[model samples]
Target chain A: MSEVNNKKLRTKDLIYAGAFGALYIVLMLILVMSSGMVPILYILAPITVGVFCGTVYELCVLKVRKFGPALIMGLLFALVACNGAWYCFVTATACALLAELIIFLGKYKSKFMYLLSFVVFNINMSCPYMIMTFNRDGFMTRARDYYGEEYANGLSKLMTPWIWYALVGFAIIGGILGALIASKLIKKHFTKAGIV
Target chain B: MDFDICVDDSGAILKLDPRTKLVMFLTSSVASLTCYSMENLLIYGIVLCVITILCGKKWLGVKSLLIFLFLIFFRYEIVTSGKGSAAIGGLLTSLITIFLFFFPVFMSLMLITQTTRINQFLAAFDAMHMPNIVVIPIAVMFRFIPTVAQEWDGIRKAMAFRGISLEPWAIIRSPLKTIEYILIPLLFSSISIMEELAAAALARGLDSGNNRTSYETVKFRAVDYLVTFMFIGLAAFFIIGRKGL
Candidate 1:
């Protein structure tokens, strides 16, 4: 176990990350695109993605048993899904780094640590909304002009600071649920098949 | 017999360097984030679409432009005009707004992925002296997206053969079963595919840890410089001149 922890990520590991990362991105894109249509679902987008993507994340981390996959996954997510928003990019990378640290502290063997890291990593879902929180007035005025008064008003009511907190809270809960589901699936199928 | 000189004719009218494409992608992404006004966003989108067309993706450029224009029209004319009920109009407005906001980024993404080849990306990243950690995964991803799409089609067919419906109504009715059915097979297939890809890559000496050479040589030409500066100028304008606009 220690030897595995100390080993550097090989080219194959990187390829595996790319493959799973692609799957993760595709799934997240479908989830986000489908849910992004409605306002309520858009608000819960992080949770939705977290719940669905946990299985991929868990598989990649467990298979590689290394540090780089999560970081690579974060970078891929930032590049693919963040829409070039610098804030989102920064937040996503930061969350991944924090997750990496947490997982490292656990030496990649602790299930509790992996779950905790995922919960932390899932906070990146709030990145797209960060601009809204920071530039509320600017975003609202633009929304008002483009989307009109009532739409802007409704958006403003939903863009409060407390809502951001609630979003983070919901993301953590979703991560927990997702990690639980992933663990069950891993035990049920992946372990038996010797894939993990 | 006269020996004829073979000219490399790839049909790309404007062959900008991959690095230039990277710059364009980043600039467009940053511009999408900073440029708030609809008119400005439209201009940015049009400029990118024109670039995409010049890169030999005429249909893609035209299609993206049409969709973007239609979204803008729908938002302003139909939804914002107060023709429908408040509930449905608001929903449509928000949806369209999100699409509009990210349209430029998506356009640039498509532009890069479709116009640039995997070898070009690898060669460009290699020239930029990026570590393998960053380069390999990205190259693999660019190569894998199409494969994933293909696999997804197969999975959909297999599900249908098994009498499993992936319709929205069916999925919503039993979400967990739907997830289990779709995700399990996809994961299993993808894992196998990755193993094969890794073996192939290793056999090609990807893990050789030497300064690898490539058949495609990436270099910056006049067009590359022009495109790079143009995008940089646009990004600067978006960031600094955003206030006046």
Candidate 2:
């Protein structure tokens, strides 16, 4: 336990994090950009990203077998996706910290714990939409003026508290499914190829 | 157009420090997000366009400005007029709004990535006394984004040859196959690339745990100070003027 706890991330681990982090981000950007144009898909972008990005992320965590990589990857995501939103940076860091804590609890060996951490990590996807909730009246008024009253009405309808709750629930389920797929892929491909 | 990360600073009209560019990116992004009026957005956008052009990315600056103008035109002349079908008009309006909302940050990102090299970033971070833990990964990530783009291009070509069209309709029809076809090869190739990169970096004494020097001398110049103050001022104005909308 001490040995596991004492291991620091070397240069190699950091590089691996960067490399895999890039891949994860690229995958996420592809998912989000493709889905973002449509309102419903935009709302569901987190689930799609969660489903696809787990493989790359799980691979990074397993390869690095340390705490810093998750936080680093989260920081990278926050930076890339911030788009001027400070809340994104805060949410991403907090979620990544939570993920790291979960992994630490498992001493970086429990596969289940890794998957559980990923579920929490997916919560950061809600960050981009947070402004809508935080400044609801301002957002709605702007939306109404810019996009017309109908569009604003639709958006406001979607912004109900229960909808956000449901979206979060769906995202968690997507994370679980994604983690399972990642574990299977790691076993089927990475382990056989000795990459893991 | 060539998308190389390293620009030839010799031809650059304005050579600002990486630190200055970073501050500009952060401040401009904050300003753009908090901004409430179209006039403020235009001012912020024009300032960024000028900075981008000065940084030697003339085509990108011009292209982004054109896109912004076009979006603004569409939003006002077409979308607001409500000439098209309501559903399609609404979708287009929302899409254009999102694009306008994020345009400044994307432009700043392009400015940073297109102008500054990885070594410059490392030197800047080092000067700031950032831990190696944070510095190495970011540097590597910066270097790797272009490589990933190149790899994705190659993969797309291969997929096309194999009759795996990445068109929206095709992707929507069979998402699983699309993922299996594209992701597997990409992951495999990326792993190999990561290994090579790690090996090369390690061979260069990346883990020596000593103070490292760089070939490029990184220091804040007069231009950097000017740019920093300008962006800080813009950000403050945006925040203070938030209620003006």
Candidate 3:
């Protein structure tokens, strides 16, 4: 565990961030496809990011060995996935910035800090669901206008406040699972391959 | 599975500068997110679809348009229909709606990715006087995405050889094994690729403070301005519509 590298990011750092960022994006695309068919699956989507954050952050530490890759990757992801609502960029950037801070505080060496960084990074994964939930009023109105008042209200009640809490709760659990899995994978594969 | 990198360089969007296309993407994406009304989003969808068709992506254009229409109609049905099947129908409809809302942004990004060449994009960024730190990563990213796809194919084949199915159910069933088998290899290979890419970029003096020149000629045409204004006006119209002012 070294203190966060204060030197400027080199070309290698950018390359690491960009390449890993692409991997993250592609993995996210797969998760999105798997989850897209059912609304119930969408709530679980954020957890996927948490699941992979361990591997990604570990790779980041090993390769770039510097600060800001998380932030850069976050910005790149938002730019590529700009199809989401505008606030996505805001949230993505914020999450990355927070992850960067976490990594900094942990000096990029503490295993716990690495896990915590991922937990914060998981916040970006929650963006789409957040957008959907927050804009429920608009969606609800459209539903009511079409289905008649009774059905829309029933649909609304079905989506209780607990669903939102459940989303965050799942994300935190996913983060823990991801960190655990990543550590195992790092020990097994990354170490064998000399990647970490 | 192919990303939107230019092949024959024949699309209508390819004629516009990459920077201009980037602006169009940003505007349309923002407008789609900002405008809450379905009708406004529909208009944006139509505009994007028309552009896609004109760019010779006829099938993509048509498919997206159909999805858009289906979403609108289905959303109405989900609300008005009684509760017998409302849960399932409502679930799918809402899922599609979220995607539909971001349709224009995705379409525009597709146009850029499919039509613009990597060097052209880099040239455009260089012309904009972006720093090397930003430019190098983005350049690497453009190259990395396609390579990752290639690696993904290799991993899939190996998995198949070992009798591992990549279908969603298979993944959901044995998540840990899947990550160990599929994700580990993907990450492992990607790391090497990243190292090589970084070396290659540095070898090309990408980190130099000096100005880099390119063979690609990137210029803004009249159509670029026209498209830009059109999107700007569309955004203004949506904002005005939203405010009722």
Model 1's CAPRI class? medium
RMSD of each: 5.0, 2.7, 4.1
Instruction: Give lDDT tens digits, candidate 3, residues B1-245.
Output: 36543344664543777777777787886676567677778888888777777766777777878877888877766656755665676555556665775577677867666666767888888888888778766766666767777898889899899888988788889888877787878887887777777687778787787888888888778887887888888987876664557
Output the worst ten-in-a-row residue range by lDDT, candidate 2 chain B: B1-10
Highest TM-score among the candidates is held by which one?
2
Query: What would the per-residue lDDT of candidate 1 be over residues B52-102, giving only the tens digit for each residue?
Result: 888877777788888888888777686537676878777677778777876
Q: After superposition, how far is residue B142 of candidate 3 from its true place, in Å?
A: 4.0
lDDT of 1 at B22: 71
Sorting all predicted structures by TM-score, with the top scorer first, yields: 2, 1, 3
Model 3 is docked with a DockQ of 0.41
Ranking of candidates on lDDT, top first = 2, 1, 3
Question: Regarding DockQ, does 1 or 3 come out ahead?
Answer: 1
Error of 1 at B90 (Å): 3.8
- Pick by lDDT: 1 or 3, better one: 1
List pairs with backbone clashes in candidate 1. Answer: none
Per-residue alpha-carbon lDDT of candidate 1 for residues A28-76, written as tens digits (9 for 90 to 100): 8779877766557778888888888888888888888888888898888
Query: Which 10-residue window in model 1 chain A sums to the lowest lDDT?
Result: A1-10
Comparison by TM-score, 2 against 3, better one: 2
Better of 1 and 3 by TM-score: 1
